[model samples]
Structure formats: C-alpha cells, structure tokens
Target: MIWPPTRPAPDPVRPGEESVWDYPRPPRLEAVRARLRVVLGDAVIAETEAGFRVLETSHPPTYYLPPGDIAAGTLVNPRRGGICEWKGQARLFDVQGGGKAASGAAWTYPDPTPDFRAIAGYVAFYAGPMDACFVGPDRATPQPGTFYGGWITPGIVGPFKGAPGTMGW
Candidate 1:
C-alpha cells in the first residue's frame, strides 16, 4: 500500500560515489509477516522471515508489515503523535504485557493514504525496547544511542544510519 500524494523519491546518487543505497524493497509484501512471541520477557513483538523494506532517513527505515500479521493486543494507544509528509499523521503505541509495561514502544498509521495503506494499523517498534527483532534470518540488535535497530543480516555493512561517524551524512 502506498500513501501521500507526494511521496519522497530516493535521492539520486552519482556513479562511483559512496552513496548509501540503503532503501529496502520487498519482493512481495504479503510474503512477509511479523511473528510475535515472548523472547526473554513478557513483551510480545513481531519478527518477519519474509521480506520487508527499510528506507534511508535520519532514523532507520520504518519497517512495513501487513496489518493482519501484527499482534495488535500487545499495543496500547500512546498520547504522542507525529507527521510524515510521505505517509500521513502517525499515532504512537505503548508496549503492554512486556516487563516494561508502560514503555512508549511502538507506532502506527491507522488511516494512511493509498500508497501506505498496507502498513496501516501495522506497528513498528523502536528496536531499542524490544527484547528481540529480526528481519529475515538475522536477529536485530539495538544500535548505540537511543535510535536504531540493526537488522543484522549477512553481507550488510555499517555504520548504518544512526551510528557514530555516519551521523552528519
């Protein structure tokens, strides 16, 4: 599902320049689903073996998922909100049932436009708070600072978005 009348296109990179072509693309959106289960604590979060895309931004790419696949029960409405020009208004969610029950843990767009409708109601976690997060075969680990979730897959190199030296780029 796509959204927003004016979605931001990927930046144009010059040939042989060390451009971070970090934007992700899924072969098939339905092929992936976030499987949620307790890892080391009461928190239940989703992991997908199928493919998903991660975009390049100041923050990490927001992982998109099918709405039916997310475990909605684990989320509680958060008072905070934000806006994305490409998507729409976003609402936050707190991770409940986890050991850290009141954590301002996740976010979603319930009524995004047609472009991003697939991710509507599908939640993405901060990765900092989740006990574990996985993209495909790799386990996601918390990146330094409060910012990123490393979807550590083989052959993928860093420093990913929020890492030290790459901060200003």
Candidate 2:
C-alpha cells in the first residue's frame, strides 16, 4: 500500500514546543495537568489542573475549566449563547469577580457533540475578557481577531486562525 504523505514542516519552534500548524483538522481534546488560571479584576475567577484543551490546526488551545474551579456565583444567567458546528450549542455566561463584570466572558456546552463529551458542562473563558489567563507561569495572549477566543502563550507557535483574510482556513 502507498504511504500517506507526512505534513509539511511547520515554522520552526524550539524543543519541547507545539505548533498549531501540526494540530489536526477535526481538533483533539487532551487532558492537561498544567495549572490553568483565569483572573478578572483582582480575582482568580477560575483555576484548575484537571482541565482539558481543544487543539485544532492554526489555533491555540481553548482551555475548558471545570465549573467547580470557578468562584461561587461568578457565572450568572445572562441569556446569551452561540453555536459551534463541532462542539454543538454553547450558552454564554456573565462573570463578576473581584468587583468586575464582563458579559459573555465565559461559555459552556451543556451537551456537547459526542467527540467533545469530556467538556460537557465545562466552561471556557475569553482571554480578552479577563485580566489574565495562565497556563503554567506564562500569561496568555488572546487570539487575534474579534470572533475567536483561543489563548496564545509563549510555547505555542502559529500564523494562526482568526486573522483577516484567513476566514477560509
């Protein structure tokens, strides 16, 4: 049988690094032991090690923190939501922490698609809405462009999705 071609080389990243270009088409959910934290205003609104990450080509990981790790009563009803073709429907939440409030700062899939069952009822925050989001010690950069919420950190390389002229990707 003929061998399937290997993926073309990604832009060079240092050892022990990840390239978003090499991530798969359908996206992969991987368990992470890294200490993930989300801070808004002066509060650590959420933190967890028992978290999962969604990795898709040309995108940084959008971390889903278990609702248990989030501060009590931080996420409240706001009647907002959106649809994800892959993950199914998402319900948006307003977060108030450390005396700050950002509407639609967090979202969850109450019933995700079969492939993303691990994150059902789990919430992911928009890095832009928070003061900072951390994977280990590095604070994350919000993914470029208005619509996407992937978190960019130092070790993840990307030309990335969500930029102008990249909608086709």
Candidate 3:
C-alpha cells in the first residue's frame, strides 16, 4: 500500500458532530464526560461518566473507561498485547459477564507514556464483541476491521481506516 494514501472525502459534518478526518495524528487524548456503557448479554459490564478518548486522523475515537466503573471480575487474564508508539504498551484481557466470555475483548495501559499517563490502568473494550456499547443514548458501531477498538457514535463521522486497502493510512 502507499505510504499515507490520499484520504477519501469525509462525510459532511452536521451541527454538534465531529469528523474523524479532522482529528490529529499521533492522537490527542482528552478527558470526556459523556456516559459510556458496555454490555454483554443481559449484563452491564461497564459504565462510566468519567473517561478519556484518543482521537487520531482517519480513526474514530477509542474510549477508555476507568477501571473502577467496570464490573468486578469482568476483565480477566492478561494476554500478550501490542505496543503503540504513541500510547506505550497495552495489556489485553478476556471479558466475562452474564455467563458469556469474549477473549481479548478488552485492553489496558498499565504504564503509559507520559502524554497518556491519565489513562493508565483504564480499560477500553472492543465494541464489536459486546452485545452493545453506547456513548450517551446512541448505540455505537464498531470501527471497521478487527484490530481497532474505536467506538463510532452518531456524533462522529468517518471514511475511517481499517477497511481493505486502507492500511497505509
């Protein structure tokens, strides 16, 4: 693939909406007050009004929930995880709730790079594997592709990366 292939035209941004194309590279981590919720089956595995989101060019925001808000005993087993040049090392987890388990459904940054220190020990779940994830009252759709954990809410728009032939972006 080409290095930094030309990005597709972004969808029009309506009032109070954000276009993923406008986000910065190397990402910007910002604290958010929006209510975020995650569910699996009948269980509400996590919910928080206090969290952070990492925004990057061509990507939807990845919401990170504080560990305290997650259901006890939900995140289990630390599987080997990958390093992000920007965020530092991430440790993966298998999430179990409502008698169901999704392997590698969550991740945390135990000791993040200084810029990301605010989110150390906070967890981010992959919306695709959960029964549902929400940002406020709107349900979130998963960012395309299996590798990214971004939660795409109605307030966000994208011709996001992670689709076929878009890897270089």
Give the TM-score of each candidate: 0.62, 0.91, 0.96
* Residue pairs with backbone overlap in model 3: none
Over 1-169, each residue of candidate 1 has an lDDT whose tens digit, in order, gives: 2233223334454554222244443211233444432232544444444334445533334455544555556677665567766667877877755445546666777887676676676666666676666664456665556544334333443445565444444
Task: List, in order, the clash count of every candidate structure.
Answer: 6, 0, 0
lDDT agreement of model 3 with the native: 0.93
Candidate 3 segments exceeding 4 Å error:
1-4
Q: In candidate 3, what are the lDDT values of residues 10-111, reduced to their tens digit?
A: 999999999999999889999989899999977999999998999999999999999999999999999769999999888999999999999999999999
Highest-scoring model, TM-score = 3
Which window of ten consecutive residues has the lowest lDDT sum in model 1? Answer: 23-32
Each model's lDDT: 0.52, 0.88, 0.93
Quickly count the clashes in candidate 3: 0
What's the lDDT for candidate 1? 0.52
